[model samples]
Target: MIVCKFGGTSVADAAAISRVVEIITNKQSEQPVVIVSALGGATNLLLDIANKAAGGELLSALQLIEQLRDRHQREAQALLGGSTEAEELSLDISATFDELAHLAEAFRTLGYLTPRSLDAVAAIGELLSSQIVAAAFRHQGHPAVFVDARDVMRTNDFFTKAEPDTDEIRQLAQARLVPLVQQGKIPVMGGFVGATASRVTTTLGRGGSDYSASLIGAAIDATGIEIWTDVDGMLTADPRVIPAAQLIERISFDEAAELAAFGAKVLHPATIAPAVQRGIPVYVYNSRNPGGKGTMIAFDAPRLPVRAIAGKRATTMVKLRSSRMLLAPGFLRRVFEVFETHRTSVDVVTTSEVSVSVTLDDATNLASILQDLAAFGDVSVSPRAGLIAIVGAGISDGSLAIAQAIAALGPIPIHMASLSATGINFTLVIDDDQVIPAMQRLHATFFESAS
Candidate 1:
C-alpha cells in the first residue's frame, strides 16, 4: 500500500478537491491511505476567530465563525451536489464551530489565552476539513473512512508541539489501521493534529502535517509515501527567489533533509526522518498538475555535484568575543545554556580562537539571548542576515563545487561558512539583499543542467 498526503492548496476549493479526488480515484486500486491538511487559509481564519473571542469580542468572533461555517457549507453544497452527506458534514462542521464559541466564552471569562487553549482552537480547521473531505469522497461513490487520528496516533503531553511516541504509535497502527487497509477501505485522516494518551488536543507545530504523514507511513511499513503539494517538486532553489530555479528530478534523503531543514518549501525537513529510517521512498508530486513526474527521494539515488540551493532570510547572527573562551571548560555548554534559557535554537555556528558566531532564526528573542550571553563576554548581534545551503550526497570532496559557488558570488561578502561533518551540505552566510542572487547564481552554476 502507498500513503498519499495532500497539502492545503490541493483542497483549497471545490475544483481543487475534485482534482484530489481524481488523483485518489486513479490510485484507489493500490488501496491508498489519504492524509489531508486544512483548506487554504482555514487555519488562519480559525486562529483569527479564536483571538477575537479571547479578546472579548464575542459578537465579532461569532460573525467570523459563521463566515467560516458558510465557506465550508457552500463548498460542500457546490461540490457534493447538496446531498445528505453534505448536509450531515455541514452539521458536524457547525458543531465544531459551536465548540469554538464555547471555548471563546471561557477565554473571555478567564481573560487570557493559554497555549493549551490556543492549540485546541487551532486544531479545529484540520478536524473540520478532514470530515468534509471524507464525506465528499463517500458522496462520490468511494468507500472512505474518516479516521480521527487522535484515536490511533498517541503523543506525549507537550501541548503545542507534541512529539510522537513511536512504539505506541506503531502498536496502535498495527492494531487499528492495518485492518481497514486489509479490508480495502480508504482511511482518510487529518494531518498535524494528534492527541495525548489523555485525549487532550495537541498539534505537531508548523509543517507538522508532513511529519504526520511520514510517521504514519513508517508505522504502517508502507511500500512508499507520496507528498502532494503546491510545487512541482523540490526545486534547485526557491522559485520565488530565483525564477530560473528548476525542479530536482531525484535527490538523496540526506540531501533532501538538508534542503528542507535549511528552507525548502516543498517538504518539512523533519518529514523525511521516519521514511529514511524505514528506507521508504517518498515521491513529491504536484497536486495541481498531477501528470508531472515530480522529485523522488530515496536512499540510493545517484549523487550529483549539487542537488539544490536553499536559503532562509531575516536571520540573526550573534558573535561572542572573549579571550576567556579559549580552551575554557564548559564554554560551549554555557553558550548553549543561554540559548536554552531563552528557548532559542542555534541554526549555524562558527568558532575561532577568541570569538564564536552563531546564527538563529528567532530574532525576536535576540535581546534575551544577548542578555544571557553577556555574563560570559561582549556580544554583538547582527540582524537581516541570510543563509544559503548547497546540499548533495557526494559533497565530501566538493572543492570544485565550492570554488564554482564562490566564483558565482563574485563580490558578495560571505560573512560565514561551514561544512557539515557528514559533508552533505556547505552553507554560506550573506546579506539578506544578496540571498536571491546567490541562490540563482549557485543554481545556474551547479543544478541548471536539466533546465
Candidate 2:
C-alpha cells in the first residue's frame, strides 16, 4: 500500500482535481490512501472571513463566503457534471459554508476571535475540498471512502498547533483506515485538521498536511508515502535563488530532514519523522508531470559531500560570553535551559570555552530568553540574520566540503558556524540581505562548477 498526498496546488480547481483522479485511478491497484489539502487559497480566505467578522465587518466576511460557495460549486459541477453526485456534493459544500456563516455571526456578536474559534473556521477548507474530491472519485466510477481525519487523528486541544498522540493515532488508523484499504477501496482523508479527545476542532499549524500524510503512512506501515507538490522534486538549491538548480534524484532521510529543518519548503520538517521511525521510504513528486522521477528519500542512498544547500532568511543569532563559563560543565546546559523555558528552538550552535553562539528562527520568546540568559553572562542578539546549511551524508568527508562552502561566500562575513555532532550538516549565519547572493555563490561553486 502507498499513501499519496496532494497539496493545494495539485487540487486547486476542477482541472487540477481531474488530474488527481487520473493519478489515483492509475495507482488504485496499489491500495492507495489519498490525502488532500484545501483548494488553493481556501484556508486563507476562510481565516480572513473569521477575522473580518470578529472585527465587526460581517458584511465583507459574508461576501467572501458567497464567493467560496460559488467557487466550490463551480468546481464540483465541472468535475462531476450534472450527475446526482455533483448536486449532492454541492449541497454538502454549501451546508459546510452555512456553518462558517454562523461562526462568523457568533464572532461578530462576541467581538473576539480566539485561537479555538479560528481553528474551527480554518479547518473548513480541508473538510470541503476532501468531500468534493471524494464525490468526484465516485462519479468517475471508483470506490472511495471519505474518512474525517479527526476520527483517526487524535490530538491535544492546543487549537492552532495541536500535537498528535501517536499511540492513539495508530490504534485509530488501524481500526478505521486499514479495513477500507483491505477491501480494495481508497481511503480519502482531509489532511492537517484533527480533533481533541473531547472532539474540539484543531489545526496542526501551517504546512501540516504533509505531516498528516507522513503520520498516517507510518501508522499503516505502508510501502511508501508520496508528497505531491508544485515542484518537480527537492533540488540542489532553491530554484528561485539558483535558476540552474537541478532536481535531486535521491537523498538520505537524514539529509532531507536537515534540508527541510533549515529552509526547504517542499517537505515540512516534521513530515518525515514518523515515516523515518517506521523505516518507510517517502517520495516527493510533481502532480503536473507525474512521469518525472522526482526525489526518493530513504535510509541508504548515494552519498555526496554536498547534496543540497538550504538557507532561511530573517533569522536571529544570539551570542553569550562570560568568564564564569570557563571550565564549567553545565554552562551549555544552563544556556539551553533558558531556550527551553521560553520554547524557542535553537537551529545551530557553536561553543568555545567561555562563549556560545546560537541561531534561532522563532524570536517570539526572544525577550523572555534574553532576560533568563542574562543571569549567566553577557548576552547580545542580532536580528535580520540568515542561515545557509549544506546537508549531506558525506559531510564528514574531511575539511574539503567546509572549505568549499566558505570559499563560495567570498568576502561575506560569517558571524558563526557549526558542524553537527552527527556530521550531517554544516551551517553558517550571515546578514539576511546576503542570503541570496551567498546561496547563489554556494550553488555555483558546489553544483554548477561540478556539472
The numbered model that scores best in lDDT is: 2
Candidate 2 residue-pair clash tally: 0
* C-alpha positional error of residue 70 in candidate 1 after TM-score superposition, expressed in Å: 1.1
| lDDT (Cα) of model 2 | 0.92
lDDT of 2 at 57: 99
Question: What's the TM-score of every candidate structure?
Answer: 0.95, 0.96
Per-residue lDDT tens digits for candidate 2, residues 108-208, read 99999999999988889898888888988998889998999889889998888889998999999999999999999998999999999888889898888
List residue ranges in candidate 2 displaced over 4 A: none
Give every collision pair in model 2: none
Model 1 Cα lDDT, one tens digit per residue, 1-451 = 8889999998898888888888999998887889899988888887787788778887888898888888888888877886877777878878887888788788777777876887788788788777778887888888888999887778887777788988898898888878998898888888888899999988887778899899999999989899999999888888888887787788889899999989998898789999999999999999989999999999877877687889889899889999999989888888898888777878889999888999998776888888888888999878989999988777667488878878889989999999888798989999988898888778778766554
Each prediction's RMSD to truth? 1.8, 1.6
Q: What's the number of clashes in each of the models? A: 0, 0
Off by over 4 Å in 1: 56-60, 448-451
Report the Cα lDDT for candidate 1.
0.86
